[model samples]
Target: MESKSSPCRPQDLGKFEVTQRDGAARLGKFFTKHGVLNTPALLPVVNPNILTVEPRSLWDEFGFRALITNSYVIWKNEILRERATKEGIHELLDFPGVIMTDSGTFQSYVYGDVEVSVEEIVKFQATIGVDIGTMLDVFGRPDMTRKEIEDAVRITAERATKSLQVADTKIMLNGPIQGGLHQDLRAKSAKMMAESEYQQSNFSIHPIGGIVPLMESQRYHDLSEIILSSSSELPANRPMHIFGCGHPMLFPMCIALGADLFDSAAYALFAKDGRLLSEEGTYRIESMVEWPTQSSHISPYTPAQVRAMSKPERTSLLARHNLEVTQRELARCREAVRNGSIWGMAERRSHSSPHLREAFLGIIRERTDPNEPSAKRIRSIIRSTDPIRPSSEPLSEDLLHRPHIIHANSLLVQRWRPPGSWHDGSIGAPSRVVVMKGGEPPWRASYGSTVQRVLKEDPRTVVMIDSLIGLVPYSLEDLSPWCRVEGSNIHPIGTKDADYSVDLESMGLGGIPVLVLTPEGSEYEQDKSILAWIDRCSFVDKLSVLCAVSPAIGCEITDEIRVRRSNTNRPVNVYNGEMHLFSPRLNDGGISLALHGAKLIHEAMKSARDNDEGSTITTTK
Candidate 1:
């Protein structure tokens, strides 16, 4: 027999890498012998006999890196079990990517009982050469009391000890969280699983199981609490799976709260009823006026084709569409995580289903209320409250340093209801602000130089460049408020000089002096090009000006200066006076650049206004 640990083996599978941790929610990559499974991913449930979509075909079409199947189903059938054992589960499924197997807990729930022993199932799964396997935990029914739940947990933990004794394949074990509705029981179960040496080098994932009833009942509060209590107690490194939760509507909340993998038989389940999954919501096959796709089951098929097609073919094709939809939602979620907008995506997805939205709101309500000692006791007694949402707050202030804020989606400016004094006036027109971080010169240091040049030369500019992107033209009609606020790094608009063609006049700031607030650099020339450009613009000379004075230098262009230096034609004024650059130490999360920029611009404007130069301030767009 080949050694599992032997290096240079052609058969060895690899591992997972933690990329970003946002509170309990993590973004990671799980490396398999075939390909990397991106974390916070959904693994669609596959039944071998059912063959909703062929596993290999799923990988080819959808880029689904991993999937979960039932070992018990395959094990019970002689032909299926024999073939899987002899040729390996991967070969049986014909899937090269990672495969996970369930120990028939869910089947047991549906069928009243399952006769398989814990050790027998684990050994069967390992021998099949499965990448990950589940231990047969004693699942708790919804009717189980605290004592009964405790017994189930204790028994499951005990079974884990005996099950792994015969297991040798470094095949990952799913140490499922199984404490029914009891929060303390859930926590205790998780802690026990975390400590037991039985779990020492064995388990790959720890999924929260037996919650299908809770989800179906919309008992979101209980579901949330169970996950929170269990996940917090488990080891940080291992992936956490939310068993049987494949609905696109539920992913944002679950993913936000730190779940890594999810599985659902929803595509098959929904397809059986002639329903199609979509980001907006599920659409019924009968009610569709138009197919979401150009060709759907409802169309391109003659009544003859529909009547002639076998039930299995129709079901399989519908199941394929539903699975495709599920994969699309998962892809959107992964992108949202990469862009640091998972919560926002969740907010939108909540609207997909009313029940889903209720569950989310329940979670949000529980999350907002500060926990009191009495409330904790009440929580223990009711067992009905929403899960305390894991904090969505960035892990640290420094981590909150997001790069840029482009309109990745529509909700950008509308959703950015600023905290504290950053509020807009009551019924204020929408505004955009481009916020960047750091203190170095825009040229030598960041993209500040490029931005400064754009704002300086453009007429009717309302560019307020600072730690926050805050640009307010007289109106908000032309540009998306979100688009105005440039996110952290300003990538050059591909091949298009957007800076020149942006048409500031149409944006309602045609005559306003552009606000080119930036962090003062160590040297005078840090912003010299911008200043020189502004000085030379024919249109700028006609506009009134005010700069928030920065200690660095220069007042807003003044009238006394306009008459005296009119003949000089310096086109650029080099304010050689010493100026302080915005540099908060690396450890501090403060935006020294933004603070200093705002102050300097504000002071310059103040100085200009004090000198009695008339500046028009109009509100009507």
Candidate 2:
């Protein structure tokens, strides 16, 4: 059945806008001729030859905004080609939302070359009204040699311009990045596609192509490297598609790494193989007595009953179940992104499979590279200091190098008010740094006497409470995560057991002598050695928590900043210099700068000018 109303064709197709972001993950909208695709979204693969589940059901029932089909396959089939050309691909597929079409690249990789020319295939997809059409580029296989892969990249780059030219203004063309398993070649492919002359207007999406083999072999580390290497170089405005990556298990990690679109036939293929998809891994249907998950399609029937049904009937049911699982996982990922816990989700999912864990570690290592393209994007997304959220599990060492954490730490060192003389007041740096260990608020009550004694001995002493997440100062005791996060093992600061000297230095406390203060059952007396150490240590006060939350903007404020309590006396607004930064108390909510407050902070950071006439003190909800 044809769509009753024609789809809205946007004037500027492929224009992507980031509506929400958490770390490197973005909740965005990619406009297309068919409709706006809210991402990170899954495009279920629809094979024209076989219908496991109707595309309409995917839109109406499952709420899928988009689906992908093979244009080369439709073109090769005479009857299907005639119907597609006459009625448009969307009508033939019976899908009203966005429809993205592939350009035989995967087919050529699998079947050893397709018959259609690059230009011909792109033109066919555009003529058939495909919202997003992929260019017929060479798919570099992981097994190929470096020289062979280089050649593949070169050929793909050569074909990109002509394919995009054929696609023209009528449809948005996908510029697929191909470099097999070679990191350098992947970067090269990304650069070529992003900078190609054809990219001026036509290219809408950047799909990292030819990694299906790596995924199939469970070489997830290599896959992670390829994605990071390629995405780093691509244009930031365009949505990135992880070609042939459809499993629900891989979605969170890929999305965290900045993948916006995913297409795969895993739903149907796994269904045919009687495998069930879950966030953890695929489970074999025959081996399970009970359903692994709750799905409307499979919950009503027993496994034995499902097995007894005809092949088509069973495949359809399982296919629906697989799609349901895929959709549910994507929803979960989107929620995590909105909540600023995409990294936590990715970390949790990594433990589901050893390969995924290896891949996660590999990504962490690659992020350390200064030249990594994803680094800038990651830093941009993680500008807010509160992205490291409290999870059911304790914050692990893995968070030490998380792009967001690093960004937060950097900002803290740069912006937070150190204990020193300032334009607004003279707080002065501490003579000694006290790292408070093992405590819960009211921290003032627990360590109030200790802090008083230390300050009395040396008025410049800085007392920092080392929480599970990071080091926080006595002034910001009521601040979240530091105050709200609960954990059993709060490691002692300055001990060889937990080495955070570099982190401390990064938070602008380098060269300061630290005295580790351990409270025994909520009370402790300082000995002579501790007193002597306090005399030797340099002073830096109220640096840790400010740096922890607003690493970039925290240190810059000389004005007295206090947390304004809500009706429940919960810390909500950070008031400083006629400005306030609102941070929701929930674990997932991020710190949002009120419009006027943003101007004040930006001006203080010297990142913006004070040209506006209005008072910068106005509040935002």
Error of 1 at 21 (Å): 4.2
Q: How accurate is candidate 2 locally (lDDT)?
A: 0.73
Q: What lDDT score goes with residue 361 in model 2?
A: 84
Q: What residue runs in model 1 are displaced by over 4 Å at the alpha carbon? A: 1-14, 21-23, 292-309, 368-621
lDDT of model 1 at position 201: 59
TM-score per model over all chains? 0.60, 0.83
What's the C-alpha lDDT at position 84 in model 2? 96
lDDT (tens digit, per residue) of candidate 1 on 1-621: 211111223342435577975444568876554456778888888899988788877778767778899999999999999999899988898877788999988988889678898888988888998777888988887788888888999998887767666565456677887888876778778877766545345566789988898877766666667677677578777788898787776777787666889999988888777766666666666645557642243457543454356767766767777777777767777767665556556666666667766765655444334442222422332232111112232322222122212221112222211111111112232243332223221222344354454444442233332222223221111122222223333432222222422333433334433333344443333454344333322112112111112211222322113211335332222221334323221211111333444465466557647865423322211
Q: Where is model 2 more than 4 Å wrong at Cα?
A: 1-6, 369-401, 414-417, 421-429, 480-484, 488-514, 519-621
lDDT of 1 at 41: 85
Query: Model 2, range 434-484, lDDT digits (tens) per residue?
Result: 788766555655665676576656666667887665776665554444554
